[model samples]
Target: MENIQHRNINVNGINMHVAEIGEGPVVLFVHGFPELWYTWRHQMLFIASKGYRAIAPDLRGFGDTEAPPSPTSYTAFHIVGDLVCLLDSLGLDKVYLVGHDWGAIISWYLCLFRPDRIKALVNLSVVYNPRNPSVKPVDYMRHVYGDDFYICRFQEIGWEEEFAKVDTKKLLASFYFKRIPNPPLLSKDFAKMFNPPPYTIPSWYTQEDLDYCASKYRSTGFKGPFNYYRCFDLNWELCAAWTGSKIMVPVKFVVGDIDATYNFPTIKEYINRGGFKESVPYLEEVVVMEGVGHFINQEKPIEINNHIYDFITKF
Candidate 1:
């Protein structure tokens, strides 16, 4: 991995740390949960080598960045505001935006709220959840499907504490490499994240990666990232301001077919109706890799970087 320089800047008065490489068209990579700027190490080098300025920043509470005290600070608007201020801090009028997981959620909201600032939008893993004027994510999911959905449970109390208490070794093991146990604990174990046996996170995560994440959570804790869930109602409420809008900029989305998210019966409809397909006026592509999972960037950097390069270069 290429070692890059870290730059400190104030985004909306919060101290934010960003790693930047190369110098050309700006391509800002935003990482997801349980990850940091280091997660984009491969992409940064690949984009930089192509003469583009590649930047990856730890979202407010995720890494070396400042973790605001209140869970409310992690709201969609606030997260997007961080990016806006980050762009201003870098003196960038607009830049190509690429994000994964939580970052994709924020990127979608940013595109909805501030399309003028993104030259192109590329998402990994997380797809845009369409706004349902009358229902929340949990209620909507329950209404469409049964209540066994894991994310619905993630919204309940003590979830963060459970996640926080997980063995860092196990968590890292799951992400770094694919070593899923046979008969994998799927729907039966998400709520039992604190349980034993196959319930524990995989061993693919290295100690170094685990240490990096654990250190950050030790200071910031999971409350901020968890708050992203708490704001579902708020997100829907805020989104009411732009009910019928679509992401009009050039866009691309990629995900792993094995991602737990695709298991949802509504996932296909969500992708089509939630603005990834022809719904987005300028959407360029949507790719679903057969064997990858939620951690696309880390699991398959070459594919991620190639798609990104191909997308941005086309524009």
Candidate 2:
């Protein structure tokens, strides 16, 4: 495995810190919320050794990337633009794209907006939810279940400030703790993992990982990333215009079966039952890892790397 070389490139009026390794057909990794380029370390090394140039960049609001002042700038449009600029900066006309969590969402939007630029796409842990042309996340929550959902509350003002004030180490530990294995039917321990307030800690995450994540947050704070939630309406408005657009490129999706994000009844039962063909016309495969969780890459790096290598080799 080759060591990753860190580089910065001026792209889209921002200086982006990019980590690249190996040299062949390009593979770009986009990290999700609460993660950075470091999340792809195992994959980067493995893919590089396999004769593919593996690259990861700190997304706009996370890690070493600049944290702009305006919350409005964190929208998907900006994120997509940053990525497009990154590809241009690297002189890649097309490349394989792999993303997890929020990164998955951005990759979905990218495939919709610019299919020509993506050779293939592999998504982990996040599914594409087509935009409701008439309503946003807040409106969807209101109409279905009132405003009791913690995610809805996260959209409110001062929410970031409150979350930012907490101990960063605890926050990272709690975030990682929720993904551990549970009984056949999510047990009390698993249920407690998703509790809102304190975000109860799990024992699996190492102190070193927690400390590293906390240090990054200490420097960047959470405002820029938190602002992503605040731009639901604008993102929806932009997405509405692309409703009928399909991801025409080759695509694959992988997720952890026990991931809390898909704990909703319909999600588990009907996820593979595809009725929305127009949204993802080229989806090639879907993989569900049994005991993993939201941090799919970290929790199951070998499986993730194998899937990525298998997919990218076809290109």
Highest-lDDT candidate: 2
lDDT of candidate 1 over 89-137, digit per residue (tens): 8899989999988888888888988989999988987777657677777
Model 2: weakest 10-residue lDDT segment is 182-191
Lowest lDDT sum, 10 consecutive residues, model 1, at 179-188
User: Scored by CA lDDT, what does every candidate get?
Assistant: 0.75, 0.77
| TM-score result, candidate 1 | 0.86
Clashes of each: 6, 0
Question: Alpha carbon lDDT of residue 56, candidate 1?
Answer: 91
C-alpha lDDT of candidate 2 relative to the true structure: 0.77
Residue 296 in candidate 1 has what lDDT?
Answer: 84
What are the per-residue Cα lDDT tens digits for candidate 2 across 1-315? 336798888878888889999899899899987888878888898888888898899998888888788878888889999999999877899989999888898888888888899999999877777776666776876565456454465566666656665577766666676654332121223323434465543443455666777898878877777777678777888677777566788888898878866664356555657843446787778888887888888878889999988886777
Error of 2 at 187 (Å): 22
lDDT score at residue 194, model 2, on the 0-100 scale: 39
